[model samples]
Target: MDTVTHALIGLVLYKSIQTENLSRESKRALLFTAVAGSEIPDIDVVSQLWDRGGEYLMWHRGITHSVFLVPLWALLLAALSWLFWRIFDKRIFWLGMLAVFVHITADIFNPWGTGYWEPFSEMRVAIGTVPIIDLVVWALILAGFLLARFGKKPAHLVFRAVACLIVLQFASQTVQGLAIKESAMSRYDQVVLAADFQPGTYKVIGKKGGQVDIVRTSLWAEPVLLHQLTSAEEADLQPLFEQNPEARTLAKWAPMVVVEDTPQRLAIYDPRFFDRGGSFLFESMEK
Candidate 1:
């Protein structure tokens, strides 16, 4: 999920808490724990400043987002709260854990996955059942906010309902994506799905030998082939990798990639991101 959604989740978590009995300073500490814990995993973005060999591609959602590290992040937030506000509530640590855990878990449903088990595993676990910026999630959160504002029910109860709806949405999309992949299995050696911006829509990439097909799929409509890509299956990539190291990083990051080799240029791109004439994630070097 995007940063805004993460922040909103943090705010909702904070709002759900009963803070009436706490001191103003203690309440401020809780707020800091919520927002900071949610946003801290993304601090890995700073890796770009120090990256010289194109390692930032792997570093961005690396070990810092790991499930094993969630507790440590929570502890750190709690320590910060103690240092700054002298608030010594144990709930702060647990709440911090929840915020960071939510951020990492939400990312798994999107096409750009995080390294949830990083340090132990280098895999990028992307389900690709939801877009990075899902409007449905935003709408649910917004509805919770409105309900709280109007005192329709308890603020915490409204948030709990919103949370349940969000889970249902994830489950629905995952099932739809799996069904689409199963349907494509008979026609292709391997298939991968990338969720489209519009819900219930997907870009299905199927590969067999040197031929790759990018197809649009939806539960309510027939599949449509958008692009047919051909590649030199045995093309040498040493030169391409030497010229653009990021190409190597991209290959490792994406679930699968298509290589394009021609007299004019040499390029590598994730078939999942294929757009009209090109892909946003394409890395190429002129020949």
Candidate 2:
């Protein structure tokens, strides 16, 4: 997800933690705890940039942003915090978990997606909807901010409501994303896909004319994922299959491809597919 969304999420989460439902000290702890955890996942980006330069941000998002990595890192962070702040050990653990949960949940909605089953697979699993920095979500942040900044007693109502709405939005995206994936699958004999609700992403890779067709939609700003396939310029995949079993697999993806260069085929499976740091073509509604 985008940084704005991340920061807003932190604000909303911090306000919620400060609610009367929790003790004042606990609330304070939650605020810092959540912020710490939330920003931690992104900590990898610094290293990635340092190591691989800005070019690595794309792939770097996968590792530190992985669900599997979040818990482990948060737990590690919590352990260290517990040891360092022995006086606030209990407070740290409880609020720390909440903080960690917020951090991860926020990322779940992020369209960049995460390696939920990382170390096991490299697939980026999306929570299934919304851009990480959608306008409507930002509005929610404003609402929470206003309530927190000026509302008198018991602003908990607004905070809780905003949090719930955000969570529900992410949940709804997950459902819608699955439906979209199923839709793509139905369109082709086979489809490999992923979805993200926070930044609202839906990407699918399927076969078209024996080539790979990659389609992705941005649920937040745009509504549909468009695709085209182009591969196998002079080769008949079926005839060459026996010589190269691996070729057989790629042969099935010859006709549908964003780009077909030697040893690399671009099977665009996310709305970001069209985003190359410049304005992109948007097929709002297609034939």
lDDT (10s digit) by residue, model 1, range 226-268: 9999867788988989999999999889888898999999999
TM-scores, one per candidate: 0.96, 0.64
The TM-score of predicted model 1 comes to: 0.96
Compared with the true structure, the alpha-carbon lDDT of candidate 2 equals 0.54
Q: How many backbone clashes does every candidate have?
A: 0, 25
Residue 161 lDDT (model 1):
82
Q: What is the alpha-carbon lDDT of model 1 when measured against the actual structure?
A: 0.89
lDDT values for all models: 0.89, 0.54
